[model samples]
Target: MAGALDALWSQYTWALGNGDPRTDSWLLVHSPIPVTLLFVCYLLLVVAGPAVMRCREPLRLVGPLAAYNLGLVVLSGYIFYEMASVCWWCLFSKAIELLDTVFFVLRKKQEQITFLHVYHHSTMLFNWWAGVKFVPGGQAFFVGMLNALVHVFMYLYYGLACLGPRVRCHLWWKRHLTTLQLGQFVAIAVHSSYNLFAECPFPDGFNMAVLLYSLSLILLFLNFYYQTYLKGKQDKLT
Candidate 1:
């Protein structure tokens, strides 16, 4: 067993060594161990956090929530600006986004933690891990750039929502946010699909993975949109 484990570790290290040298020394990209552990901890928190909060009152986090969302808005904008130079920040943003789930659990907003929410948050880290590891730039940067831009507006909307009822009432573009997200996914799918037929320097496998992932998100978001907007409107009318 010990010898087998040693060989497995050696093979993992060899694979890591073959990844992009530019990102090899960057944080969380040196080895899969750190990111894997982080992912596991996130899952554990998702499972355990609600239980811990079950007995406690939902903490009112008005101030902190506002700050957090606005901060992310700034960070997302900055990532968009700097995406051309660095890709690791995009990967790191995925880890930061786990905080969204944490906030949901703290507020006892269990309904907000849907399968699409958790799956999108959790899987992005690993997918971008492979992205940042092997194909750090190229076609992948387009997806990151577009995502960061969308997040800037997304977080801004959430931050404004935390201001008060007055501010939220004025925020009439809520449904449009989902529309924007769907648009982003569509744009990414088209961009990634283009690479599939073209002679791109980036890996075809990565493009295909992204194309498929974007399609999955489109379906999931469409379901969410229908349930949240269309069905709710119809129910109200009846």
Candidate 2:
């Protein structure tokens, strides 16, 4: 049994070594343990955070939330800019994004902590870990760049909305954010699908993974849009 475990561990390390050499020395890319541990901690917090806040008043984080969202807008832009030049930063950005859920928990915005929210946040970390681990650049950069671009606008809206009623009143394109997100998924799916079929240098496996993941996001976001906007409108009219 010990020999078998040793062989399994050797295979895992060999797989890690097979990835982009440029990112081999980079943080969190050396082993899956760091990201896996972070993921586990995120799950633990998701379960424990709200429970811990049950008795306490929800923390008012208007200023900090505004800052956090705006910060991500800047970070996302930087990632878009540096995407082709380096891939590690994009991987690092995923770890930073995990804070989104933490903030939701802290603010006691239980409604915002939906399964879609948790799934998206948690999965991106692992997905990108694999992306950076292997096939760091090439077609993978397309998805990262497009996602970063969408995040710029998305975070800008959220940051402005956090400034209270006056700011939010001007932010009339709230529903449009969901539309934009859906559009992003569509674009990514198309891009990934094309590369999967084309004679591209990027790994077929990664392209397929991206294609499937984007399709899943499309379905989930469509349901969210129906529930939040379309159905809500119908109910209001009734």
Candidate 3:
């Protein structure tokens, strides 16, 4: 069982050019054919798997779900600790972290994937890709740690959401989830900005891009919260 879970993670981890890949170009870094195939599979699963579940009696793998969520938290925490200790591998890990959204898709839950999702998913991979290619051991570590802690909470919500309405009432933190998500971006921007100006090895260009990108996400999420949760009288969360 452990081996199988490791294999699942390896499948995804190996797909993202090992994050700290030897090369920069996608073609030369690794087997694009295999990696692209796996990435496409992930994208398809997220985009289409939900509809399939709605059609097919709702597939449930609570055990894997639990492990995946908590396991990622542990992994992210370790990486964060490593970053804080010395080596900052968050940039590379974030590259492979493109798979984070797989959690939302598998549960047939659209509620978790919001505008924040689009922005984060779309750019996190690219930004981390840039960081890995350009900024080796960049300050992305701080951001990754913050993100992991948030995921501890986010995936806990996901794990409970998987319990199907029996535990749905406990998922009351959706509004705060958005707030927390927004907070993550703010923290990322602030920290990354500080690292940019402070004595650092990473390039200012990388810092600007990531910080700006995260800021854009913050604004988008704030607007989303106001419209979805705050503006509405009733809780329309899913």
Candidate 4:
């Protein structure tokens, strides 16, 4: 069965083929275009979403936001499951995830695309590109799987939050969501750093570009969690 599936998938490689890996294909995958373009779109979202908050209405943002998060939840789950079977699945799934940013752009709901959102989305894309493009299968597959597990609940909560005024009192999982996301980044960073260094003694040559990218994501996520959650708590206490 696996052999037949491999044969079928091989025949369809052209349809799924992305980078060349021979002539600078590696460079192209790690290029800044995807990240820069996504950042610009995200900035516009943050700036514009609040401006139009009055007209757009929080409830109006609920449906699409819910759907988007829910889709990601499922996507993360599938990717994680496939990775467990054939670790390389993380790379394929991450590359496909670049489209999520497009959804954020189209929705014009910048509020949904928070700093954590942008950081997570952008890093995941580049990290996977790095993985598939260079690092084939190492600790990466595990990290990606862990992330997908968390997304299932994260998106569900976000979907509920989108409902606004009619939102159930217990629907608010924002605090826990942020906490989980932070932990996810920290774990990725630690595991990845171990693989990168000889400290953990994992195989080398998986791809340095993405290793760096994942590390940066950890730093940014830590900062974001500190500012968004910790600071918020401090203000509340004050």
Candidate 5:
């Protein structure tokens, strides 16, 4: 059994572009244990966090939430900027991004913590670990850059919305944020699919993984958009 597992692991690593080094730095951050541990903690917190907030009144985390969103904007920007050359930034940024859910849980915004949200965050952690561990560079950085660009706008919107009702009144773009997210997934799917026919150094498995992931997100986000916007509008009209 152990031998079979080892063989499977070896094939998985090869599919992820193991031995392709686009950047050189600390070995510890790229190691599998730390990455796995970080994600495990994130998933545990995802389950435990809301339970802790279950009996408590929702905390109005205006100041902290704003700081958190803006901080991510900066971090995402930096990761996008440095992704082409520095591999550590992607891994570090992904680890820190889990704080997004922590803030949601802290504020008792349970409704915001949807399947799509958890799936997006958890998969990102896992996928980026694979990317950072194996591919770390080349065309693999494209998704990070696009996601970072989307996050800059997404988090900025959230930060402004967190300010209060007055600020949120001007924030008429909430639905558009979902639209942007949908666009991000579409863009990623299209870009990743290009690798199917083109000759690229990036592994085919990585590209296919991205394409499939993006398709899943697209379906989820489309459902969210229809339910949140289209259905809501129709209901009001009826």
Candidate 6:
């Protein structure tokens, strides 16, 4: 058992390398077990963390939450600019971004930690792992750039909201955040679909995965928008 595990680890680690000695260090993250374990823990937390807090009061992690969001804003920006140029840096940044849900779990904001949220965060780890392993450059980097731009604005909004009721007045467009997310998915789907016909060097499998994934997010987020915003507004009027 131990030998088999060691062999698996070695294979995944070696495969993560891009044949560049300068960045071979970053390939250490490709250890399949650790990455799988991390996501498994995250999934368990998504299921049990909220239930554990069910009887408890919601936590007010005002300062920590603000810092977390701001950190992501910076990290996303870094990934946006360096994704194609420095694949490891962007991959590392995205690995850190997965921690956002940990904040939600800690704050007992389980309601905010919806399935879509968990699914998105958790899957990105694996998806980006494949990306870093296979097609880590070229037009493949566009999605990360778009996602980073959106996250910069999104996290900036969350950071402001964490400041307290004083900032609520400026946050009138909270609903628009979801709209922006939907727009992002639409853009990703369109962006990915272009590869189907265009002569891009990126792999067909990865492009198909991106297109299908974006389409799924579009449908899911659209449902969330309707139920949370549109339907709620109608309920209030009637």
C-alpha TM-score for every candidate: 0.93, 0.94, 0.67, 0.61, 0.87, 0.85
- Candidate 1 residue pairs in clash (backbone atoms < 3 Å): none
Give the per-residue lDDT of model 4 (tens digit) for 62-143. Answer: 5566676777777767876777454445544554455455455455555556666666665665556545544445555667
Top-scoring candidate (TM-score): 2
Superior by TM-score: candidate 3 or candidate 5: 5
Cα lDDT tens digits for candidate 5, 112-171 = 889988888878887877777667777877888888888888889988989998999999
Steric clash pairs (candidate 5): none
lDDT tens digits, residue span 1-238, model 6: 9999999878766765543344434553444555688788888888888788778887888998889889888887787776677665565665687777777877777678887888888888877666665666766678878888888889999889989999968799888888888999899899889988899877777789999999989988988988887997898999
Question: For residues 120-204, could you state the per-residue lDDT of candidate 3 as single tens digits?
Answer: 6655655544454444454756666687677667767766766677888767888888789889989889987897779987668
Off by over 4 Å in 2: 1-11
Model 1 poorest 10 in a row by lDDT: 84-93
Which of the predicted structures, 4 or 6, would earn the higher TM-score when compared with the native? 6
Candidate 5: C-alpha RMSD to true structure equals 2.7
* Predicted structure 2, TM vs. truth: 0.94
How well does candidate 6 match the true structure in TM-score terms?
0.85
Error of 4 at 10 (Å): 28
Compared with the true structure, all predictions reach lDDT values of 0.91, 0.89, 0.64, 0.60, 0.81, 0.78
Report the C-alpha lDDT of model 2 over 1-238, residue by residue, as the tens digit: 9999999899888877787788888899978889999999999999999999999888879989999999999999998888897677777888998888888888888899999999999999999999888878888888899999999999999899888998888998989999999999999999988887788888787888889999999999999999998997899999
Error of 4 at 38 (Å): 7.8
Error of 1 at 47 (Å): 1.0
